[model samples]
Target: MGTISPIKESTCCDPASAGTVYLPSGTSLILLMPRLLATTIHGAVDVLKKTFDGTYDDNCPACGETHAHGGICCGIPEIHCPSPCVCSIHWVGCPGDSFKHAIQVTNTSKTEREFTLTSVPFPHTQEAVAVTPGKQTLGTEESLQAEASFTIPETFAGSKYRTVIKVKGAYEQIIQVCLTVRPRQACGCHVEQGDIPKRVKAHHWYHHFQCVEDCFEPAKKVG
Candidate 1:
């Protein structure tokens, strides 16, 4: 038979401590050591706060506001600066006249934003293109319309040309504008000019070097 050992009083399970104590009558006993723990309401709250960051109803980290024009993502507010408010013009012409269009820019941010507009002219171009109010500042949720003009030179005779309009600053956008030159029909006549009386011929369905008396009219009148 095995002999049983008695438990020491000093080593007994204490009610103040967190542990389990068991006695096997006059046989054996088992004991489990207690584990210490320290926690407070403030500590628990901090843990919860870290777990649910940027949840709904929380302030935005980017703009430091509860709401923004664009929704929040990853605790950051969406910035909508220099967003284009205008649509691109595919083709513009007025038959020996100038073309003009309106371009709108919007600043959806909560603060002011700077903007600049410039044009990229193509090679072998004779017309002059420009933008009005090219550079300016915009306020929150504010918008501005810039006028774009393209003057067709009398010497312009190309079928079409493309110009790239660029807006730079807080935001950026590239708008492509295509301009077409009106075609001039053949007048089926000849013109004499210059010191030597240069003569110009009219090709089939094409304009002559010089304008004729009845170049573009209902009835043909040679002069």
Candidate 2:
């Protein structure tokens, strides 16, 4: 008859939230682990809070509040900056005179705060969208303005020009200005000293230029 012997068994385990940790079962170590350790929330919730954050019905309600500022990421009482506002496009003109447009960037914060405008998508030449005055500081009940202008050239006498105006730091706001130049027909070759010229020249040139070297010759022979 074979003798029965006690078999050696391995240790046991209880999962943890942040990461896996070996704890001696039935000891004080089991009580110390957080309740959410085994769940997916333990491994990813903190990472979600760290990058590419946004707010809608249950998130921060403002811009730049997620990355720059710290907040608790929960299902309720969404996180966001205290103040939120936006700049927008107001007007666009067609070929009429010159390109011109304006904008008003406001501060919605009730408390005093400072902001520095750093733009990558500017309205001109695909350059860094930057504030005209540079390193601006706005307080409560304050605003900023910007404008664009372009003169009409003689060649494009009746042509239109478009000017894009975008606010710095505020990516959403954009404006396009249209300046229409009145039409100016070319000088009348027929008119001489402010007199009827093209009226008479066009008449002769149309047929005269077409007839070429033999224009008057053929008429002379017929006459």
Candidate 3:
């Protein structure tokens, strides 16, 4: 145990000393602020791993497509760890005519804390499907571990998916985890920089007409 260095003028302890000083559960409420640590600790490498060696035994082989191809269903997006690890979706081969897929997230926070996950697709979402438990009291036990999981969706109708993890610790520091998704299906119609509109203004009349007349011109820009 470490003693908090005292401050002047006030009898109360400093906010920076909160992490070291023991506090009751829920007493250590973290204010989600931009930055509290004046001395920024470079984020650790985020990592993701799956222990699904035998989770799904009957599901068919995962569709290789990145996006929905009509009848096939894909796993959800996931993220993990702040450093020393990479997060993404993974597919594993299973027994005859079966396989498993998962979104693995990992954290590299040296300090133990609570983690919450949410997404725009499920805006009203509230709850922590995954989290790392804190350590036991001093002279007791010090555990080192992190937690997260694959959040299943109700439907696969979304064009894309994204999720975020908000980590709040006794130190009052907050971190974010952003997970991005990609569709499996390839674009039937190629898009080029020229095809994209800018400034949100009306495009040239002649250019718009020419595009309808000779759409091939735009395709050239794609290549």
Top-lDDT structure, candidate number: 1
93, model 3: CA deviation in Å?
16
Off by over 4 Å in 2: 1-102, 110-135, 186-223
Give one digit per residue, the lDDT tens place, for model 3 in 1-223.
9999877675887878878956555533453233344224323211111113332233445743343223445566466545522343332211121222333233345554443332222244442234344222222133334444444333322234334443333332222333222232321356566443433344588666322234334534554
Q: In angstroms, how far off is 98's CA in candidate 1?
A: 1.3
lDDT of 3: 0.36
Q: Point to the candidate with the largest TM-score.
A: 1
Off by over 4 Å in 3: 1-122, 126-129, 132-143, 154-164, 183-223
TM-score list, all predictions: 0.42, 0.29, 0.23
The model with the greater lDDT, 1 or 2, is 1
Clash count list over all predictions: 0, 10, 19
- Candidate 2 matches the true fold with a TM-score of 0.29
lDDT tens string, model 1, 76-131? 44677664634466654545676788888888888898988888775575444689
Q: Cα-based RMSD of the predictions, in order?
A: 21.5, 20.1, 32.1
